[model samples]
Target chain A: MNAPTSIKEFFESGYRQFLPHVSIDCAIFGFHDNQLKVLLLKMKNVEGWCLPGGFIQWAEPANEAAQRILQERTGISQVFLQQYYTFGEPERNKEPNLKDLIDSLNIEPAEDNWLFRRTISIGYYALVEFSKVTPTVDLLSDECCWWDMHELPKLLFDHDLMIGQALQTLRMQLNFHPVGYNLLPEKFTMPELQKLYETILDRPLDRRNFQKKMLSLRILERMDERKSVGPHKSPYYYRFDKNKYDQALQAGILLGF
Target chain B: MNAPTSIKEFFESGYRQFLPHVSIDCAIFGFHDNQLKVLLLKMKNVEGWCLPGGFIQWAEPANEAAQRILQERTGISQVFLQQYYTFGEPERNKEPNLKDLIDSLNIEPAEDNWLFRRTISIGYYALVEFSKVTPTVDLLSDECCWWDMHELPKLLFDHDLMIGQALQTLRMQLNFHPVGYNLLPEKFTMPELQKLYETILDRPLDRRNFQKKMLSLRILERMDERKSVGPHKSPYYYRFDKNKYDQALQAGILLGF
Candidate 1:
C-alpha cells in the first residue's frame, strides 16, 4: 500500500469511523537461532520504531482487533494471541520526539486529529514460529522486521515499556502455560525446547531437571523421528500430544523453580 | 450518601468530566466464614447485582480509578489489586435487564449519556482481609454486601462472566504468587492457610503435600503464640516473614502442582 496522498485526504478517507482513542498494539514474539525476537515497525518518514498496531473499530471487540492487526502486519493468523496489558498513562501522547515526528509528517494539528490524540492502547502478544512470519509494511510504516530482544532500538510512545511488560508477562506464563510449543517447529527435540525456555527465562536450567519436569507433564509424545543439527548426535523428536496437552491445560499445570 | 434524586441532577452533578466509554470495575474478593466471597452492589430501583465500579478520570490511570472505586465502596485501601481482564464486547450494553434498568431510570436518551452508552471496562480483582472492610452503598446502589461465590445473585450486564474470569485468574495466580496472606490474619494456623487454599482452588488438597509445599518456600515464620478455636488441639500459628516474602516476590516463585 502506498503512503497517504495528503494529510487532509488521510483524515477524510482513513480510520475516521474507528474508535478515536483506542488502539491495539501487538508484540509478535518469535524464536530464531535460539534467540527471542520481537516484531517492530519502522515509521514512515521518521527515524523511530513502534509495534505493529491499528485502531479498533467502534463495533469490534478488542481481542478481535488484536488478531486482525496481527494478521494485517505479519501475515500470520490463528496464532496464540493474548491480551496482557493496557497502557493508558495521561502523558503517553506527549512524548517529545513523538510530537516532533507528527510535526515532521506535515499533518496539521486539529482537535479531530485522532492520530495525535491521547490513546489508551490494549497490548496483545503472540507467539509464532519464526519461519511462518512474512512481515509486510503498511501505508504508515516503511518496514516491518524482527529485532533481537537484547539489541532493540528506542521505540516510540512508551512502546519500550510495553515490550518490557509483555516480556515479563510471557515469562510468567511460561512457567504454567504450554507456550513454548508455539515458537518451535511442529516437531522438535528436547534440547531445542530447553533452549527456547532458557532464552525466554534468560537463565540456564539444569538439563536433567528440565527434562524430568517436562516429561512428567505427559504433554509431549515421543515421535519415531530424529534429526541431527550440526555435529551433535541425532536426538529423538517429539510433538505435543494435543489430547494430553489440552487436558493439562484444562486442569492446569504448575512447574516449580 | 443518598441516591440521586433525579436523573437530570445526577448527570449534572456526577462524573461528567471523566473519560467517556471507558471505566474500571473491581471484583473485590474476600475470604470469610471459611468460604470465598465477592463484594457486589445491588443496583437501586433495579433487580440486579453488579461489581463495584466507577468511571475513569480523563487525567487518571485506569489502575488508580479501580483503587479509588474499591476504596469508595469498601473502605479498604492499599490492598492487593490486579488488572486481570478487560471486557469489550460490542453488545455488552444490550443485556436485556441492563437495558431495561437504564430505560426505567427515566433519563433522557442522549448520545452523551455515559450510563447508557457502550463501555469497555477494565476488570480489576482485589484481595482484602474480610474483617477490615466496611461496605458502603453508593449513589447508584441501594445495598453493598459480600455474597458467597458459590451462590452469587444474577448480575447485570456481563458481570457474571467478568467474575468467573477473575476467579480463574486468581486461582492461576495462587500457584505461583504468595496471595493467601492477603486474605488471612497476621498470624494464621496451618489449617487456616490450607482452608484458604482449598477455598480458592475449590478442591481438597492432600494435607501433607500442601504442608510440605508451603513450608518448603521458607516464607513463613513460626509465631510464639497459639490459640485454640474449638475442640481441636492447638495448631501452631505462623506469620509471614516480610523480608523473606518480599525477596521471594522479587526473585519470583514457582510452586509446583
Candidate 2:
C-alpha cells in the first residue's frame, strides 16, 4: 500500500505479492533411436502433463529464467536455451479464474485480486540429448517422463501450442544447420543421425542423398570405424569436429537436414 | 468488482479487466545508401520521433497486436515484424511514474488508477522499405520520420536496447537471406544493396563477390538498364521481381558468396 519512491523501490514494489507474475517454461526436446522425445512433468492436482516451467525471478535476467529452471529440474546446466516465442493469449488457462492457481500454489483463491490472478507467460525451447539426461521427480510434480513426441497426451493450458512452436523451430533449425550432433550422443552412426533428423522433419530422406549432403558439410570427423551394435555390420560412426562444426555453423549450416 | 460462479459468468463477472501492459515498439528497418534507416513515428507528445508501438489487447493474438500497431503507424500493411527481445528492466522509463503518461494521453492527472501506470514493454523489429512507406502517425503519437541508424537520439525507455537487438537481427537476416528487395526501393543499383548490408552489419563486403552472389540468387530482375539518379551514372537500377523473389525464397536459395 506504499508508493514506490525510487528505481529499486519501483522494481521491488509489491513484487513478492504478485501471482508470481511472469513465468518461463522450457520445451526440452532430444532425439534417440529415431524418435523425438519431450520432457513432461505430470502435476499432482490434474491428470495432465506440463512443460518444466518456473516463475521468472526479479533478480535474475528475464531471458535466463528458463535455463535456471532447466538446471533446477534436470541437472543439465551447460546447454544453451534459445527463446523463440512468447505465448500471451488471454484465455490460455482452463480455470474459470485464478482459483486453480490459488489451490495449487496455496494462495487464497480470490477473484478480486489483480496480482496473482493474471499473468503472461513466455515460452523457451531447448534441444538436448535424451540419453545423457537424468529425469527428476521433483516434489512439485507427481512424475517426470520423456514421452515420445508422436505419443503425447493431453497437455495442460497452452503447453500444446508451445510444443508446436518448438517443433516448428526445430524443423527450421534442421533445414538451416546440422543439429543432430547436439540432439544425439557423441560418436553416433550415420543411421542414428539420419533417424534423428527424419523424426524432426517427419519425412523420409533418401539414405544415399542424405549421407552425401551431410558429409559434404565437411565438418564430420570420422571416428575409428564402427563396432557391431545390431544385426548388420554397423555403419561408420562419426563425431562432428567441434572446430569445424563451429565454422560451418558460422557459414550457415542450419540444423535441419 | 464481482465474483463469478460459472465459466460464462467468469468472463462476464466484470473481473476480466484488461491488464495494464506495455506496447511493443518496433522500428521496421529498410536499407538505402550507405546509411541504414528505419521506419519510425512522430508521437503527439514528442511529435514525429518515435517507433510504431501498441498495447497488447485483452482479446488479441500477440502477433496480430504487433501487426495492428504497425498498420496504424505506417500506411503500409503486412510488413514482417519479428520479436527480437523484451525490455523489462524497471529503470528503462524516464517518465515520472503515471504523471508523464497522464499529461500526454490527455487524461485527468488525478486518474492514478489509469492502466498506463504498470507497463512492461517488449520490443519487436521489422524489415520495411523507406520509399514505399507513407508514415502515418498513430493517434496517440504525433509526427513520423525516418532517422539514420547511426544518428539515433536518446530514445525513451529501453528503446536503445531494442535498437541494438534490431541491428543484431538485421545482421543475422542478411547472412541468412538475400534481403535487399524488401528493404530497398524499386529500381536500385547493386551498389545500393551492397551498401545497405554493409551499413546494417557495420562491416565491409567485397564488392565483386557481393554482386556475384546477389545476381546468382535471381531474385532481382534486371530492368532496362540502370537509370542515372545523381552524380555517376547509377549502375543500372534494378527492381525486385516479386514472383521470382518469392519462388527463390520458397525453393530456399543459398545466401552466400
Candidate 3:
C-alpha cells in the first residue's frame, strides 16, 4: 500500500495502508543547559499541542513505526527509544466534537470512518541529544518544537496524561536503565550528569551522594579531562563505558540515588 | 455492546462490539512451592497452550479489559496487573494457516474477515495468588491450568514470546516494584520470600544478603510468628507493610538485588 498523498486521502483511505485503531505516540525527551524538554507538535487548525504520533503501517513493526514517526518529525533515528505504556481509554482520542474538529480541517468522512474509532496508542519515550534534532512537522501539524518539561502548554486529547505516564515510566526506568547515553554529551562533568537526573526526577539530590551512587554503578569511566571553572573547582569529565553500560542495562542492575 | 455469545458469532460480528485488530493477552504468574507458574489455556479444539487473552470491548478501557479477561479465566481479580509491552510485529499473530486453524475448530468466515487482519496485541502480566485462583475456560477454550514457568509446553500465537517478554519485564520491575505481595501468602517465612526472588530471577542469592537487602528497604515487617521447621531452623515470618509497600512502589525506589 502506498502512503496517503494528502490529509483527505489519509482520512478516507489510510486504513488500506495502516492498521486501524492503533497508533504510536512518542514523548521525545532531550537534556540541555540543566533543563529537561519534550518534543511537541501544534496540529494544523487545532489550538492545543500533542505528541508526534502516527498510525502503524500495515507491514511495519510497531517499534519501527515509532522510530519512523520520530525520524519524520525530528530527523533523528536510532536514539534510545523505550515503549513505556499503552494509552487505551475508550475516549482517549475523543474530542468534544471530532466532526467539528475535522470540519475545521476541511476533511469530511462517513460517521463510521476508521479515524473516528477508539484508538489505542502505544507510548514510547526517546532520549535524544538536544542539539541534533531538526524538528519537522507532519501534514497535520503546523509547528514542531521542544517545550520545557515543566512548562508545557495545554495538550490535545489525552496527551497531557500520556506525557505524565511517559515521564513516570522514564523516572522508574532510571532505577535500572543507565541514563545520559543519548541525552548527554560524550564527555560530561559529574555535575552535568547529576543535573540531568535531578531534572528528570524533579527533585534535588545531595551532590556527594549522587556522585557516589553513579560511580558505584561502575558504568561511568572517569576521564583525565576536566571542565575548568576556577583553578580549584574543576570537575573531571566522565563518559559511560558503552560496553559496561550496555551490560548493566542487560543485567538490569539497580542504580539508585 | 454485548459480547459475542458463540464462537461463530465472535468470528462473524465481533468487530462491532470489540476493537478490531487490537487485543489484550495476560501472562498470569503465580508462585507456589518455591516455583513460579503461569496460567495457560487450551483452546477448544487446539492442542497447544496459550495465555488468557480477549479483545477489548468498544466501551471498555484496555486495562479494565485485561482485568476482566483475567477474572474470567482464573476467577481472580484486582491482582497486581502491569501492562509491560505491546507486541506489534505485524506478523506476531500470523498463523501458517489461520483458516485451517479455524476450520479445525469448525468456524468459517470470509477471506478478508476482520479476524484475518493483522493484530497488535497489548501484553499485560498479572501476579495472582496461586491458591486463590479457580481456572475456568471461556467459550472457545476447553481447559485452563497453571504450568510451571520452567516447564511450559508449546504455546500458540506468539504466546511463548509474550511470556518471555513478560517475565523479563517482571524481573526488571523487581528493582522498583515490590513483588510477592500478590503471589505470596499474607505471612511467609524469610526463606520463602528469598525463594520467590530466586525463582523469578532464575538464580540463587546469598540468603543472608537477600534478607539484609530486603529488610533495608523498610517495606517488610517481621511478624511475631515463626514457621517451625526444626529446633535449630525456625525462621521468623515477615509480611509486607501494605502502606510502605504501596509508598515504595509510588516512589519508585530502587530495591536492588
Tens digits of per-residue lDDT for model 2 on B1-257?
Answer: 32233323322332243345444678688665657787766444552255677666566666777887787666677776777666655445444343443465544533334232335566788777776777776544456778888888556555666777778766666645667656766678888878777777788899999988888887888877767777975688788888887777556554642
Clash list (residue pairs), candidate 1: none
* TM-score against native, each model: 0.91, 0.71, 0.94
Report the C-alpha lDDT of model 3 over A29-142, residue by residue, as the tens digit: 988888889999988767789999999998999999999999999998988788989999999887744554577778778988888888999999988898999999887877
Name model 3 segments beyond 4 Å from true: A96-101
- Highest lDDT against the true fold, candidate: 3
| Candidate 3 TM-score, true structure as reference | 0.94
Give per-residue CA lDDT, model 2, range A1-257, as digits (tens). 33234323323444552224456778999777777889999876676788998655545555666777787777787775777777666577534343443477654523444343346677777788787788875545778989999999888888888999889876776655667656767788888778877888898999998888889888888888785888987788899898887787666654334
Model 1, B1-257: lDDT tens digits are: 34346556666554445666677889989999989999999987778899998877767777887888999998878887989988879778666434455566776555565565567878899888898899998767779999999999989888999999999998887777776667778899999999998998899989999898889889999987887877888888999988888777677677754
Residue pairs in candidate 3 whose N, alpha carbon or C atoms collide under 3 angstroms: none
lDDT score for residue B144 of model 1: 96
lDDT of 1: 0.81
Candidate 3 local Cα displacement, residue A124, angstroms: 0.6
> How many clashing pairs does model 2 include?
25
